[model samples]
Target: MATVTTDPFVGRLVDGRYEVVSKIARGGMATVYLALDRRLDREVALKVMHPHLAEGSDGAEFVSRFRREARAAAGLTHAGVVAVYDQGIDGETSYLTMEYVPGTTLRHVLQDERALAVGRTLELLEEILDALAAAHRKGLVHRDVKPENVLIDSSGHVKVADFGLARAVTEAASTATSTILGTVAYLGPELITSGRCDARTDVYAVGVMAYEMLTGRLPYTGETPLQVAFQHVNSDVPPPSDVEPWLPAELDVLVCALAARTPDDRPVDAGAALTLVRQTRAALDPAVLDRRSVPASSGTAGAVGTAGTDRKSPDSGATAVLASVAAVGAATAGASRAAVDRQAGSPAPAQPDSTPTTVLTGIGPASTAHLVTTSAQGDGVQHTLAMSRGDLAVDGPDDGTPSPRSRRRRAGWWWFVVVLFLAGAAVGASWWFLSGPGAYTAVPGNLVGATQAEAETTLRAVDLRSTVKEAYDDSFPAGTVISTDPPAGGKVRKDGAVNLLVSLGVKMLDVPTGLVGTTADSATAALEAAGFEVGDPVEDYSDNMPAGDVLAVSVPEGSSQPHSTVVQLTVSQGPAPVTVPQVVGLEKEAALKALTDLGLDPSSTDDYSETVAAGLVISQTPENGSEGHRGDKVALVVSLGPPLVEIPNTYGRNVTEAEKMLKDAGFVVEVRHPQGISPLNIVYAQSPEGGAGKTAPKGSTVVVNVF
Candidate 1:
């Protein structure tokens, strides 16, 4: 049963182009009416906001938002999305004309059926998500997503409606402290609190709706709308299986993840959510999807049980033939009734009775009414024929004579029977030859794994023709038969062509040459264009490759990979810098070990030092605390003990002579007097004195006594 609406504007015409037929439904924001577009001569649903909502400041603001959002929604074009035809204002009322759909809302369906089968629920949700994906692509957010907004037609095709009405109401209620206009259960936290909306906001609403669809109940309920809104903000949505334990765990995981309290937890948009839903649906067991236990009397027989129309008799052609035969039998019975009327001398036409009726005829007053009538009734297979002995009597037979002509007349019926028999045989033979078993032959044996030549030979052997087509197949080998058109063990007419799908082997695509040294996004696009799929990238430090640039590909360049194969990319983390270790003042062996531990190759050289001990490092190349990569070589100078020198004897020589002798001995010369000494004077005696065969470093300074 449908609700009857009789508003004052039911018979009014708006904008002279739309004629209002009748009000269909009333919602919080507007009343929907079934109207005719006079200009286009098509039916449309006219949603007109209440005049009171267009009066005050809040109402004015709501109407303004309605017009804007309606136009935005109208810009969207998709099969699953309900189209907005026009939006305008007629006098003080704002109305929008949209595609008039003949169907029930998802809310009505849920109310009637309570819960839907897993397959049906997913089917509906997929289409709804597709609609949302289209809107999200166009940068539109359907702030309200609930059962009430989704419409399912007679064919079970879903169309989503009422895209922007909920948000308009929210904007109108902004000034009021105690007002909430849409379904609080499906409202996102941001929409309820700050009236802000984005793609994720719609994702949240869809999650809540999905929960209701799966469990036949909402995740949250409250006495007041505000309480339900609070629940969406504060509480985590329980798993759908909590209400119906038999539900699949995947469904529960998807719902809980989508309905997360924070915006970041949900899918980036409806497109992403749709992908997960399709993947999850493909993994579900057939038994789970096919489960249905509802009774016909429960008002849910056609909801998810029957997909479209009901089945009648086995086929329609047989029913038509039977009906025609019945009609011919009725006409013959009518003629019999007319003949009986003439014999009985009744002028009134005979009428068919509900049951079989009897009619008797009399020739005169002395004659008996021996004509017993049996009416043709029911299926006409069993019918009555009026007959008399006189009707079959012949004039020659009355003379009690057995004439040859009378015998010939008796043989005429036999001739007619023989003709009928021959005619029936001809008809049956023609039917069999043209359309029966003779018209078609059994297809050849399996060709799925056969070679192309072998399959063609088999098909030709069976009196069938063959055509070949090539396609890439991941499983079958190249040039082998993947499948046949009529399929193996199927029927095909003799000489009919069998399309053989020959495998061309796996599809191969080369890696894009321009992918190297490019950003990940650019590389991904290039790879996809080349028919390869981009896999997760691995990060590593490179000495030559810059950071964030592709360092290497899993498949070498110029090599072919199967189409859609995941190609892993290695992105560079820039050069690997090594810390130069401090190796000076340490033992040569210890210094070499320290540098090697720091990933630096160490080499040592022996050097003589006057002040440093032997067997220790004097200095290192590249110095300490300098940047170098791993495996970089470091050169270290080791100290040998101070060089020993021999001193010549100068005690018997003059100051000048002793000074010259000491200076020539590879030692520094100094002049010393008792009080003051001349600048040019030389030493009289050396401090270590007159020692023989002493050697020193070439640049060493020596002191000599001078007078």
Candidate 2:
């Protein structure tokens, strides 16, 4: 049955900017996807944490540690380290946007080749150690050092990734059990036994990786992770030479020391380990360094045949010559080995070269004959006769020697043949020195790392013609020679063309369009993906742009810049804040002036109040000290004051009539009767006379006396 799997985040935009394109890989804690930072329009790797790891109990702590450690990883500025860009939490989904390295993981390469050549292995291992050294100097330990975390780019640059992530996860683990959080095969003894790790712990893992690379097998194995952890705690690591006998003694010593059960027994850090590795590599003989261990199951013949296939051939004609030379070397090697085995009377140690042979002969299709004599083992001269198969016959009795007369007859022609051979050698030697292959000289001196002019000059001095080819090289500066077609010490004929590969510096990349107006985060991610580093963004207030949006960039969009250039981004801090006008006590005109001067729009409403004079300002909406942007409206309430009326005198009038007079004056009216007498309808007296010049608030009441 086939299993079906789908990625839910594909084609989905996160935080309204990153568009996940495709899934790259899935790990225990997160699934990494290739995403496009749509606003900046460049690709990035998006590692989204699994939902289970981002929710439920202890999730917040895990998320917090993840963010803190991610920042620490970002601080690592080494070229051999992967750069972390951003970390964010959206709802229940926690994701980290990081550098999208275009290459295969070390694990993938190991799967294909099983084992690597010693020189190549050392080169990659040194790069890994370089990254670790940078981290260690900053007081950060990777905790997890395995092939899966190592990346080899297309240009053969190695980068170590996932720095500090394993430690973060282990810190957040709920249980205090001895279980470790990384690959069990590479765990150090201290981590498995005491749950403690340090820089030396990383060195131990590297040692394990070195052993695996050299022997094509892990030093320990188990069906369960716990079982593996137990072995790391209890058992001592064996030397790689135990599995691969061809490995040199120095390599075996290095691996064994690194994989020592005690952390104190190994190198103190990656830097210490690196020094020892270089020393050991330098001490190895060239033959030992070049020897590759072939799998016993594949057999020697199969390994040799696979090496000569089309897949391993180079584009240069020199490879063809080398192939022929290798064939001749194999033949001579086989004949020598056969003689050794026959003399020793025992089978020699198995060599991957080829099966040994006592003699080599071939019969021609045409009716022709040729005789060649060569010395063989056991004090005897053997004569090789080549003829058409139809003319050849084996009529000699088995194990019987030739007659004495026959041998004498053959000896009579020996002198004639010797003279003929000497004459041919003399002629061949004359031609070789005069105009043949031997007259050609070697292309001298190392061309790599030299300036193009220097390489050209060296080539010309050696009587070789030079042709220039340009390529991008991260390590080499522009105008320097990266390599040569005939290599440094290879031979070429006089005036022969030697192609020189000149470095054009790191590849140039164009800044993507639409960087402006996007959020600063998207722009930064885009710039980083295009091989440029983003400096801290400069923040400024803009009248028209919203806060947190990009205003401009130091480098314009659509311009080309060398890889890893620093680009400064200008981001808006939103419109300038407008101060609310202090118009509560000012008159309408005065209030309007204050509001307009502050770039605020003002409007008014009217109401009557006893405490305030007419036409004076009462209060304003968006009150004093309230913040508003430019051109934002502020509403004001204006005062109309209290109403004035003439109080009517009720001395000669009835209570009801007097009350009506006072009530019509915008005042509440009241009538008073004698203490014990029945109330009368007419009023005899009132508190205030309703005449001109008396003023009161519209709701204030007046009292009247009744008779």
Q: Give the per-residue lDDT digits (tens) of candidate 2, residues 1-707.
A: 01113677788899888998888888876788888988778888888888776566777888889889998998889999988888888777888888889898889887877777777778877889889988976789999899999998889899998886778787776343334688889989898777888988998899889887776778888899888888888877765544554454456556765677777666567765665567557755555565555555553311212241221112221111000010110012222122212211111122243222222222244633333322232211122233332333233335666456645544544444456456546644654554443555555657888999888888888788899989997779999987665544444556787888999998888998899999999999988888788999999988778899999999879999877678999999987788785789898999999998887889999998888888999899999989888778999889988766566666677666777777776788766676544545666656655555656677577887665
Candidate 1 C-alpha lDDT tens digits along 352-424: 3445433322233332123222235532211222333344334566678858887676467345435544654
RMSD each, Å: 24.3, 17.2
lDDT of each: 0.69, 0.69
Question: TM-score for all predictions?
Answer: 0.42, 0.46
Superposition error at 44 for model 1 (Å): 0.4
Superposition error at 88 for model 2 (Å): 1.0
Clashing residue pairs in candidate 2, if any?
647-689, 647-690, 647-691, 648-690, 649-690, 654-683, 655-682, 655-683, 672-706
Count: clashes, candidate 1: 12
